[model samples]
Target: MKTYLAHGTRFEDTALCRFLNDYGHADLDALHASAREEPTRFWAEVEDAVGLTWHRRYHTVCDLSHGPEWPRWFVGGELDLFENLVGRRARATPEQPALIWEGDDGDLRRFSWRELDDAARRLTTALARLGVCPGERIAMYLPMVPETAVVFLAAARLGAIVLPLFSGYGADAVASRLIDSEAMVMVCADGYLRRGKRVDMLGEARSAAAAAPALAHLLVVPRLGTPWAPQASGQWREWDYRSLVAACDPDTGPTIHGTATPLMILYTSGTTGRPKGVVHTHAGFPLKAAQDLLMAFDLNPGDRLAWITDMGWMMGPWLVFGGLLRGATLVFFEGTPDHPTPDRIWQLVGRHRLTHLGLSPTLARLLMAAGDAGLPQPGQLDSLRVFGSTGEPWNDAPWHWLFESVGQGRCPIINYSGGTEIGGGILGCFPGLAQKPCGFAGPIPGMQADVVDAEGTSLLDQDGDEVGELVLRAPWPGMAHGFWRDAARYLDTYWSRFPGLWVHGDWARVDADGHWFIQGRSDDTLKIAGKRVGPAEYESALVAHPLVAEAVAIGVPHPVKGEVATCFVTLADPAAADSADWHAHETALIAHVAGLLGKPLAPARVHRVSALPRTRNGKILRRLVRAVWLGADPGDLGSLENPSALDALRDYRDSLEAVV
Candidate 1:
């Protein structure tokens, strides 16, 4: 139970602990009992634990007349999350820094609570004047600047659905989302920096808007106005969003507000076609994200939180609400985590005295590969209280190193795994529970998580641990309503796995000691000679090699075995790049994989690649790799922060066929 996730104070005897012990049941069972047996008391306990402000107290806690299938959240409630994030803080602490923004060009922008409120109001007013109505969709394609967060909150405050697109996405990808959401206006930028180069987002976005006829106004922020023009709207020679903000009154027709109003549409990759848009209501999103922030990481008022992410991803909203609602300062860097130097992240950790430093295992591996020869003194990360992992399953070496090297063995790494649909982790850690390396602690506070066999049967007894599909038998506040326009797909995707249960597409397990582990995406399951195996198993083994920096495993079409395991790796150093040395390294790595996962299922080939294509958030798009290897279309490369890696992959793939 020792943890650096807390503010260094032992909370073994807190209310959280009392509940865990008093029920005598397991965590999920206890949560279900509290939720069903004493419904009012359950949500009340949730509210108190989460520090939810009672603007107008509720009459009922759990009321599901339509059963769990069509559950209504907070019925007869009148709560606005806008008040929780901006109004509440602006009223109490006007001068506190609500957002700390840093540009790629080293420019710093800080917004206080009052400043954020005024800006959000101005932006909200501008949207209202543009004929934006409640429940309408506004597509936002921008970077990690202050304006990006402003537009998100502005759209949310006005009860408009915010659709976020990664600034790096090309016009085709951008057009798909805009048209799907039927967004009337698009909030974009003239250009944004990436790896010290300017990217013309506004120009491309304007082109994309043309395809989206529904797009009415292009609210382009001229970051580097240089020689850009809006494709359709030629009325303005230059578009200054600040001028639009200046012309509007901060008070805009009373702010159309509701708790259950549609807030945002986040897309997750579908089996085919464009990603499915997952709709989340305003009330549940901010409230639950805040609760997880408090319960999972023990976020505090003075803590400074920053995770390298873009608003297009779920972490964008999660970080926003979690940091702002709890009165913690947010550190926003609209640049790469390794920008300027590999030590930039560590430098920030030391400089900001960061109490909660969130990171990814991929980025950690990258830094570790950069060689701590470029690292700072051991005390540089002394300010780091807790380290967080999301987006992917972490490997043990990286996990142990993050605990031992980056955290200096003092901070516990919280391995959180959830999807965009869930808003927050359905399965995560509280840090008070015993943790094993590279394993999740358990489900979140209100979540009822279980690992079950393929036949929807429980795999373990009390405190049982076995590999199975991760499921939630009961409802939690963070679960999404459904895919924006694909409700049947949602039901068919999640609920169809079991009766009245949500089966998150992940292979998970719990050991006898109750430590949880995520194998990989269930959708990415590989069948080698009819044996179902997760790509993480092989990728994890390959990374165990001392020379391999990162690796990705995919199921390739094989004539004999039907599907064979293919692994592409990025070595620890470019000096190991020569095919001969790399081949030797791969030989040793292959030997290890064979030793770990014997004959028929062992890797068919271990190829060395210069780099792997990943999202801006640093998740290996293994599906893309598989697609390219099979000569299939790699759906959308626009979300990839590193597109050149795909070219490199294609070249390597061609080289494989050179001898074919």
Candidate 2:
């Protein structure tokens, strides 16, 4: 029998139910169909339902005359994201909790709606005093502090685009983005506490600011009471964060702009080449994020939503906009989840009473490896209503463990899959549907997505067993305004492959039960002999064994089979894997994989490692693995959290090459 964390009765009382009731939709399927069939009407209703207050309403929902590649949404509309996120909400409920932040050293801080609005107003005034004009770019290189949120919204209030850099980025990675966007100002912190250690960020900001000639101002927030000595550069000026706030008055006035005006320029990790600035407009990203949160995650007023993310990643901005737009309280944690103790996250849930919590599958596996002994008591997690996931594809083992252990089989795992450019979820599990362990309910509303053949001539719906490239037939509001200053690259990357369709690089298929499963990135597919297989399939089979913590499968050169599979895995116990009897365990694991996937698809070799190389956001760098194995130049190491793990992988690769 299939296990269900939430039943139909549980979903009937959700925020999605209330929204559908007001709109007179019978169920989620009807709402999804309505959104796909008549997107304009659906979006118009959504604007009103979500209480979007615009200076001037849009004439049309979207203009797709130029095709999906160049979609213009909310045409002729003018509004301020700050007004929607802070101004209106503050005016209505000044004392309501807007943001709750917890520091690494066990310090807690909170901001009510009015308090956050005042912070944004003061910051905006200070920015304007610094000659920050509309359409300029301001870079933010800071920790997940409350001030970070203020800086983001203040930049929007001034009609300036904010470029959020990852907190972990070094000088080169930081300077590349600042130079690319021609950022005028940078807001940074002196340092931040992580894992009981202080990490200095001001030095990196200074180095980046020195290289970025466009930078004219450096605003430093002193988190550790450290004095900053700015380089005596004639081209730029330095100011203290507290001093600026104290010297300026709150600017409570509204700043409006055209609907398509750029609000943010978030740079991709430069996985393929130079980092492309993915531009997002006010109405574009905010509306799509709000809609996805409402319909997919069942967000609403009074709900507390928390996700483990950084401002540099899309989820950071997504949650910031989605939570406030939906009138839900947002929770921001400034440290690692399992820093001081394995129960830290659980304690936060019990303390803040977060109803919706989101994390990546890698994070969940890490916690699972830590074991459930330190977890909260059963009733301690009573406030949690939904468990959300994103980043990468989930294996059945970790997904089941998270569902059973964390949720107690009473909360739904709302699996969301999308990209930085999409703004929100492309495929998501709705609260109104019965969810599988690792399957999405369907594509999000208003997203006309399907699994189509390579040529895009026909849909691959062969009894739900056909796997093909995922593509979107129609344009949605959340789609990026194209890569900044690189329209040709944007078209070539997404639109050129399938004519008019937006070719998402993921290989996906819809099962007979209407559940969608993303196999992996199409570019990362492996060919063994004559059969093609996704890395996820092989990894999933390996992770089914109790000894394996995580696994990554790659196609290595084979003498006779043309190409064969090899898996690098992290065991549950590294010491045990290093013992003399390790060969027996490895043979047992290989046999287990062969039993699951057959000998033809079984990995020819399996190696044990202490850890896998992953990005800060928990995404495995598969390309980097292949590159290290083949001794090729790995494109970018900016997003890597543990670069040292690559050294261990290289040693393993050298051993394999010895046999070859």
Candidate 3:
């Protein structure tokens, strides 16, 4: 009953039961032991063992001037990210295939390490000739083609920060980021195919560049047919990436990038308004990225893997760097998952024999909706050894189903959680730990996590297990350098909340057995008749019912009664079809919560929708829902993966007749 284990060795079967095993209890103890004695040295050894490149050796490992609040990592280092990812790979094995991209149209392409290096060189030289200088910014508004990745590294080679905007992002989103970074140039495609529809990226970029004063040129790569009317964008210029590379030099000059300098600005959904720019640096970016791939995924050279995401998101770089740094083959699909069929990803997994599978819970839920229609048989993904998930809490059903069905119950589903700023996961379970379903075994080896109370006190429940706001007692290499051009804002946002502690804003609590659980965000906490309630606690209660497929609960204002638990739930097929049964099921669910915890818990206000308005990474936009309930304007729908979902929910809101 495991995902797919060879020779009849099930996932539940331990080393004692299975003839073959990748890692077991002993390996976990060894990893923990190493971290206990000088964690910095332990991480450094891992970095060296995994063959990480460095331009100049570091003088100090870490400097915690204000404790873990404002710590400096990899102090006194200098190296361009491209050197670590591409340069050494090309030098050692030029012909080794670094990427294997498969578009939704079934077109496939492979780029060797040498070819990638040469292409990057040509692009770098062409950019240099155009007066592109160090410390400048170049925005990449391109599709998921190999050229997009090349453009990113090319910018990095010259110490220029590259900003990636999702091709689907509107003009406003583009203008905000472009103005923020003051990008001098933008790389984009004339048009691209998604589910076989033509999208005019050039047209969108053209309109946006008009608002951005700093943007000097529009560099278009004609991806589709011959040019229509020329885009009246900035500079009115275009470049054939391949042709420019052919004419340009194969070798560019050496770089002089500081390790702590800004490498990229990734945006996260802000509850208050527009997305916040989460900045990361050159040194911290690659160190833990490789470490995460090595130990957490146990990735080896030449492995093939893919995750579905827009390039504008953080995982775009994470997938690219983590896969390539370990010499693993990268795969990308530029269309909707359900375009040709629900089985698209499974088909790719089978076709490429992808060694690692990265997914989001929302994607899993969509696949679950397809039921038997979407999934292939268990052994179809026999090559998959590791599965990673991020963006939100992993529900038990989807986690168990994904583990048991596609993976065939053998591979480890690495439940990873970290922000874009961390470059990689602060909390991830390695294969060495017991691969329990829907559980994060523990924190990443070097990351020291703390679950503390509101007053900066470490809290443990009655069972003597930690359950509180998650904080870091010590700084790790992957922590964000700071917010871009806003250090005071960064301190106030993350550190000042609890004073001198890296309060991550998430409600993390551990069980008596030391298993960790993230109970949604602390900012998402609600007050129900004086008792503080977390959405995770309430949502978990609702999801335990057989009828529910997905659940989202937010506190709604009640004039005399303060706030009541008004939950919106999507039901499973048969139960949802029967109105009487649905109401009965809702009644039972509320009673179940009341019995479990001493409260009325409120009956569910079930609303059936095609989908929830989630982010690209699958995190539910609860703030958006709350804004709608209060009749306030839902600020910035830019991060929404499906903006149409909000329109569908208006009828449901009208049915409620909620008054702000």
Candidate 4:
């Protein structure tokens, strides 16, 4: 039996409805088919609908004669995204809010379209004055604040490539990206508040700047305080952000660039090997993001969209471009959603009247444990019409909680899944579709996605129950131009799996009802007794229990079976973890999983711990957990959010070995 959390209604007045009516598509299926059959026409209509301004029109929509992997879009067109998002929009509607920001301390700030453009123009003038050239790369090591957004637009306005680094990243992590991109000028903040604490951001940025020889200029934003003084002996010179902006003129226009000009280089976080810098272009990423938000999420003018993410993540840039291009307001909230009060997220939604809210399932679980203790009443979230989720696969427990408690069973949860390399969602749940909990309605319009077997045979179309790798049969604009200066690696990473098909590193399946669900990362799949299973299956079953807050299941070497499942569990109640019947409690949790998945798929061992290793984005580091459990070196700790968690796992493993 299929259970639907929500059903689509005929909202004839929505942005999506208007767009479909423009194309004579009353049903979503017809719209999707139109997009797939005539992608050029679809995108052309999108370009016109979004009112994208081009200095020079393109003679062709796309030139695939070179090859699908090297697609040239909007050839001969020249324009900057800032021109559409701020320049023209500001001139038309100067008083409308472009961005709204709130600090953890209840400090509120709003920027009108005119104000935002002026700030960006001033910053651009400052950067140009600092010797930042048209094609140079500038690194931004700042938090999720308005100034960060200003610098990004300013860099793009001057035809400079922006490199956004995670705020939580240390000096070495920052230096690695700077060295890789050879960024010339770097903009950073003095500090930012997180969980009521001030992180020493300027000190770390200074250390990273001192290490990167290519960094010639350091622009510091006095966010916390100007703690460090600029030194003549240093390799690069530093300037205060306010002083530089004040010295510059805001009455200037952005320098125009070609459609194919490099816009940004976002480094992908990895558990192994050096991180790959994924390059994007002027017309590619921003257009795809805007189109997705418009067509899929129904974002329109006056809608305030807020996605709790950092500027470093792909969602940050996606939200900025998607929301602003549609003349919608972007809402940025600093600090954790559950800080000061567990219902802080609800409070923000009520306070801002945000229409679209996006968050990860991991964060939902963290707050779900808090129950209604600090949560606002049910009616407080009435302003939110749509909920968006991404990052990792969701268990039913958290998904149900978010759908019923947070949404009050009225709003539909748009389960979106994509990557940094792909600017927007490859698969998305549309507004007018029958939705199953934790299942994607289908691939995003124009995306030819399929589940294929090891030999590249279609699994879902053939109605096979076997899980297979997800692959895209056609090219999309948002696909990264190529790894920065590493075309060979790019080819090997995506195209090498299947000839011409981009094999996404995820395990997916389709049930009889045609709903798609991503199980987990393909590399994280566990094989026990010749049967394959994703760790999410076991982890989901374990977390269904009341006592378990979160859990991670890993495949470990077994004496008899080729491999067996072992779980590291985090308890909801720390005192319960220390109870005298701890052994019996562990046995009960194992038995619960066995009951859900049967004895053949049962976990061989269960260990209770305070935390599991995760990336800064809240994805569980299964590879790192397996490495630490086997006493192997955990490669590439740069993206690991907590080094102490690794040490704790190592100590637990050593103690177990000692007893053995």
Candidate 5:
């Protein structure tokens, strides 16, 4: 395996190195082992290192009386996330930039620490006047703008739970979360600019408010500068966000609550069931996010951080809470990455002089496919010190392109992998460690992570070629307390697979050098002729062919082989679809995969397509791809970014059936 050695100078001054020196540890591996063996002591150190403010001290760092599946953290402590993230920072560094926003139309806005806190105070007073009390859920469906941050801080200050909904969601998707959470208030925008066009969000928010009987108020931000009035009906009322804030006095103080109090109910949609609301607390999610930022990513105060994400995604809250708690300036973009121009993202990085930037592998693929002209010019990304990746497994070509072309081989790609339920990363690459292409250094501290087979036996000590399920032996502070109001489902989803083990449904493997790599979702694993193979393996092979830009491999039922791989791919040069040699291109791609693996494991079919179904965060829905191909129900598509892509897949399926 190819490896990228970390520069010794780079590790000399990183946060991880400083931590190791302070604790008298020689390296990260030693600290990790110590953390796993004594989690309570490790977490206490982390809490103090991250500088989390507490109104009342906790007696215990972690309480496991309810078992690992339902562990309580920071027991008996009283704190408020708003106070730590905003109020404290404002008091200490009032002149520092706290938040910066850019609109698709080239409009820019910046807020200092003091200014952000003052705005949050006004909004908190407004929410109080609306009768929003502690524990009440406030659903935010607004775009990535300054108001989104204000609303989050405002709700958090009042001890109210914040539910961030995707700005791209339709009325039905918005209403489902509102009704499920029984949210008393919904915040949205009048409209926002995307691709230089205005998207009317108020209409959808209004429709959702009407559908949710429990919703009592609709607070709208005038993002488009268009005249709008509230259309009140029954107990539900609409109010202008600016007007409401202006009418109230600033609520200068924060409402303190128990450390384990629910600060957010982040709902993650499943393949076949209702969206699972993952509960995160004031001390739980924020602390984990800050810890990861400080230790894993080496984020520091005054550093500018930006991630291409929507407010509804976990990274959105992760960025807001973690960046602020670390005293970093946040950069929010109110449109797609490629909007207005292909180099829009690179322009943002250069314009803001961002120190750390996070993006998905899919986005990297998209940008890489755009070729040399589409990438940053010389000296454009000189300010970038580190690159962060998550959301999906990375292919070698894109990963290499990002590492070599974009970063110029100077920075490390901090590959982070975990789920919404994990609150943060289970495994991540540290700035202080050597990295391999598409590989993780190992589990984050406090996460007792291991690779196991069907019997729940460790695979790390076995052959280096084996791939197995990723499981956590002990609970970490960042784990979801439980699914909101769905205790049975939560237990069954993660805990039922192995006794006392948290089965994180992803296939993983470790190389000879102890570098970890995630294949793909274990549920998406394909069994061909009794041989278990990850879709990433096949997808990786297909994309290696020069013609293919992106690919998704899924298992198709076969009477003979039990299951066979069927592939769908989008070409690097889209115009190649209409070429007369398209059939030859597909045949060559099939042979390439067979050459990489064996003939027996080769794909049964390869179809060229324009796009695949993906979530807002760029995770390709392989289950939906297989389901649509089989004319099966593509369940729970609320988070789907492009429904039209599914329609294209369905049309291709119908054409195949007609030909048969």
Candidate 6:
């Protein structure tokens, strides 16, 4: 593997170094060991370092008497996350930029810390007047706009649990989450621009509100400036967002709550049933996000941070709370990265002078296919100091392009890996660490992560090459409290597999250099000819080919090998698919993969398509692809970004069956 070293500053100049010095630790490894040995003391120091204010101090840092599965953090403390992220920041730095939004058509909106606080306060008053109380769920189904951030802040201030739905969701998808959470108020938009087209969000919101009986009020933001009125629906009432805020007072203070009080209920999709609501508390998610940003990513006050994401994704809230808590300016874009032109993302980075940028490996692969002509010229991305990656494991080509080409070999690519239930990240690359391409330095401090085999034995202690399940031996602040109203399901999902460990369903390995790499989801692992392999291994090999833009490898049932790898790919050039020699090209691609990995590990077949099924966050849904290929019922596709891709796959399967 190749390693990249940061060329900008010495290790002593980083925030991680300063934190280590303050904690009387010599290096990153030492701090991590100390954090594992003394979690309570480490977390107390972290709270102080991040400047988390408590209205009423806690008597204990953590209470794990209930075991690691249901540990309580910050017992007896009282503080509103809104107060720490916005109210205090507004009082301290009133004129500093808190949020910056850019529309698809190049419109701009900026809000200072004080301005954001006032806006959120007014909205909070409006919600209270509408009879929204603490513990009541408030659903937000809006695009990535200034109002989206305001809704999150207002809900937090009003002590209402936030339920964020994806902006691209259809009426049915939106209704499912609303019904599950029983949200009383839903905030949406009139419409939004995507790829120079208008998306009718109001129609979907109205349909969803009617379907969900629990929804009472619908607040709509005029994103496209369309004049609209409330429809005559006895099921719910509608209010213009701006008018409601104008009619309310901004003096209503934040509602205080205990540390473990529920702040948000984020729903994540499963393979076969309804989406599971991952519960996060007041002091859990925010503290972990801030710690990761401050200590791992080296994000500092006044530095601009931008992650291409939707308001519904975890990174969306992660960016808002974490960036604000760290006093960093956040840049939110209202459209896709490659809109109108391929250089749009690079242009945004240049325009906002973003210091820290986060994106998915799929998005990186998309941009990489655009070539250097579509990228920024010299000095365009000079302001960038660090790059963050998550959502999915990365292939070498795209990872290298992001590091060497975009970052100019100066910034370190912080490969962060974690799920919604984990709050932030289990593993990440710190600033002072030498990073290999597409590899993490190790587990985040205090995570107590290890790679274990089926019987829960450490794989790191064994010899030769080995991969095993990523497990956590202890609890951290960011672990989800439990699935909403489904404690049994939560326990069965994470803890049932291992007696006392939180089994994160990812296949991971630690290299000889002590670098960690996540292969792929454990459930997605393929067993072929008595050997287990990760789908990423085949997809990475296929993507390494010059013609392949994106790839997904799935295991299909086979009589001989029990399962065989079937690959689906999109071409870098769409015109290539229309060529008369397309079959020959596919054959050559299969040969390429067979040469890369030995013949036994090669894919059985390669199919070309225009696009692949992905979520709004740009993670390819391999299970959905496999289901569509096998003619199985694809369960819970609410989070899928492009449903049309599934239709294309179905058509290919139909064609193959007809030939048979």
Q: By how many angstroms RMSD does model 4 differ from the true structure?
A: 1.8
Which segments of candidate 1 are over 4 A away from where they belong?
Answer: 1-9, 13-40, 54-56, 225-239, 252-256, 462-465, 528-531, 581-584, 598-601
lDDT of 5 by residue, 1-660 (tens): 878854422787888788778767778878887897877878898898888878899999888898889888889999877888888878888988999999988899999999999999999999988899989999999889998889888888888999999898899889989998999999899989988899999999988888999999998899999998789589698898888888888896557889878889998876676789999888888889999998889999989999988888889999998888888999998877777777888999999999899988888888888777568877778888889988888999998988888887877899999988998899999885788898898888888899998999999888665889999999887788788889999999999989999999999998888889898999889998678898999988988888898999999999878899999999888886675887887788888999998998889899998899898667788889988998888878878989999999999889889999
Model 6 segments beyond 4 Å from truth?
577-580
The CA root-mean-square deviation of candidate 1, after full C-alpha superposition on the true structure, stands at 3.2
User: How does model 1 fare in lDDT?
Assistant: 0.76
Candidate 3 lDDT by residue in tens digits, 1-660: 122222223333332112122222235546565566677777666566556667787787777775675677667877757877888889888998887777768888888899888888888888888778877888888777887778878877877777888777778888888888888888888877878778788778877888888888677777775555554444446565556667888656567577777777776655555466777677677677777877667777878878777778778888776677777878876766666888888887888888887888777876887889778766677777777788787766787777776566667778888778677887876654564555577787777677886688777544565457888766777677777677777788888877667888887877766677777778777767676677766766666666777778777877877877777777766445575566666677788777765665553354545557787556788877777767878887767868877877776678657553
lDDT of 1 by residue, 1-660 (tens): 232343343446333554555544356456756665665666567666556665565666656686565566766566656676787788788998888877777777889999998899888888888888888998888888788778877887778999988778888889888888898878888888877988788768877877887777888787765765445454222245777888998853334354557888887655468778988886677777776777677677767898888888889878987678778888887777788888877777786677787778898887777777435577787777778889988876787777776666566677788878788887677655556777776777667777788899877574545567888877665678788888888788889868988898888877766667788877777888667777888988888888788999998877777888889988777685586576676677888988887766678889888889888878888888888888898876767877889899898778878989
For all candidates, what are the clash counts?
Answer: 1, 0, 8, 0, 0, 0
TM-scores for every candidate against the unseen true structure: 0.92, 0.97, 0.90, 0.96, 0.98, 0.98
* lDDT value for model 6: 0.89
Indicate the TM-score of model 5. 0.98
The residue-level lDDT of candidate 6 at 406 comes to 77
Q: What is the C-alpha RMSD of each candidate to the true structure, in Å?
A: 3.2, 1.7, 4.0, 1.8, 1.3, 1.3
Better of 2 and 3 by lDDT: 2
- Name every residue pair that clashes in candidate 2: none
Give candidate 4 misplaced runs (Cα > 4 Å): 5-13, 226-228
Which digits, one per residue and each the tens of the lDDT, describe model 6 over residues 1-660?
767787864678888888999989888889888898888899998998888988899999999899889999989999977888988889988998999999989999999999999999999889999899989999999888999889888888877899988898899989989999999999999999988898899999998998999999999999999988888888899999999899988955557888888889988876777789999988999999999998889999899999988878889889988888898999999888888888888899899999998888998898889887556777878898888999898998998888878777788889999989999999999886798888899988888999998899998877855889999999988889999999999999999987999999999999988899898999899887677788888888988998899999999999877899899999988886665778898889888988988788878889888889999778899989989999898988888989999998999899989999
